[model samples]
Target: MSHPIIRVAIADDHPVIRMGIEAAIDEIPTLSCIGAVGDSSALVALLEQSACDVVVTDYAMPGGAFGDGLQLLDHLRTHFPDLRLIVMTGLDQPAMIQALHASGIDHILSKADDTSHVPAAIAAAWANRRYLSPSITQLLPARGAPRAIAALSPREHEVLVLFVSGLSVNEIATRLDRRKQTISTQKTAGMAKLGIDKDADLFKFASELGLRTARPDTE
Candidate 1:
């Protein structure tokens, strides 16, 4: 008996990236590229019209009726709770990674890293397992002094992580679905608990705590 083919969709703003992912999917006998879209709106439209086993998408695609980044992810999670999503992006900051995980994305791939693992990521997602790029795994906070991250409440920790990841107060507020003032208060409280008084100090503290550098290496 033949196993069912896994119908996959690719969503990214760049045509080249979409094509590359499609080609990768084509190489796998059990997987088929059912849709390739440039934005979240198109992705949603395609999903409404067909069944897809997995969706591989960019994290920061702009110019769509449904928005992008965390918003797009949130929309998909809310509307299509059963769809498996694999986010492939250059945004590998720890806070963003944490947020994506919290948002129910089980697979993440780094655009700056090699694409050889794309097939593996898809396979893992198809099997309902989590897959994080090695580059992303390295960015997670190392096991160390428990008090470093334990001092803050869950919301506070989230705020601090996003802040340290370089998201502005308003942007984080928008992403977390909280008011600007609430996010500001959480930032202040979290920083106070961590004894971080300045932006530079916060970055330094986060670095020491094992958050990866956000800068991509230049070739």
Candidate 2:
């Protein structure tokens, strides 16, 4: 007996990553790469033009009008609920893991996993089954580490986005109509919840998580 083809779409900000996934999909007999896009806008366009059953997307894909991270996922869920989604990420932050799970994502793959797992995940998703890559399974906090759900509140998210976007505490307070000390406290608390300390690491964390609306405007 034979199975129907599963048309797949790839969404990632990195061209190299997209190409690799495209090649992997091409190698599978039952899987077809319908399109590969570098951002959410192009992904949306491709889906609208082509018939795609599954989407393999990076969690941190930015540079799109729809934005990335939870925002992008929400857009997909709302517009393409039937499409099977496989989220790929490099971060192991418990808060992020909790957020993704809370969003009802079934297949989460860590970038550290071998590319071969991508085919396995695609097959599982096409079958309507949950599949977590080995690396992703290891990253799951349930395996021993405290299952922390330090999800930032709405205000904390806003404060961190502005801070990571290159705004000073005073500037953020002014823009948000909050006190400078309050903004500082929120920023510090957000960093602590994410297990980050230094400013450079905070910027990297925000970028990796797509917390900012976009990349920092200034260097």
Candidate 3:
């Protein structure tokens, strides 16, 4: 029997991020930034003093214990169970994402996401919908079917390892002492057979297959 506007608060260490989000929030007629705090203590203090429809919290502060966001969420739930939470961070791993999803974080957005997507995630948080960015969602393991085990030639698997580790065709060629065109053809064939397009996806799939030794791409 009541129309409730979405009350929003922000807790992030960066002033620039807060400003950017506030600037974006201004364009949305349905939402407003009623409070913005920096760090965990400020965040907890504000949430205790005021009732917010949603809290846009960051993963860490200048001095936060690990899993600080989860701790804060647990605290918020104890006091204000009805408050909608939208946890956001730059961390983009399936295990971390799965943990956040299971922990009552309704909406998760990656900082690497394009600016236009922020508003949609916020709106979904307000609507109590599961908001997943295309980039982040794609990292989630497939549903309903186990991946087919490809019996790649040992060389094919070896090349895929370097390829996923961010080696360009030329780099892979140099690293493996092979011709560039040959390595390129192999990578292309692997991509087609694996149904993967980008190197990032290739890395994720390789990691899922229990190959987790990407050296962070020296080249």
Distance from true position, residue 7, model 3, in Å? 0.7
The TM-score, computed over Cα atoms with residue i paired to residue i, of candidate 3 is: 0.60
lDDT of each: 0.77, 0.80, 0.67
**Model 3 scores what on Cα lDDT?**
0.67
Which prediction has the highest TM-score against the true structure?
2
Error of 3 at 141 (Å): 2.3
Pairs with backbone N, CA or C atoms under 3 Å apart (clashes), candidate 1: none
Tens-digit lDDT string for candidate 1 (145-204): 233454567777777777888899999989878999999998888776665567775674
Candidate 3 collision pairs: none
> Which candidate, 1 or 2, has the higher lDDT?
2
Error of 1 at 41 (Å): 1.0
lDDT of 3 by residue, 144-199 (tens): 12332233445666678777666788998998888998888877675655555677
Off by over 4 Å in 1: 142-219
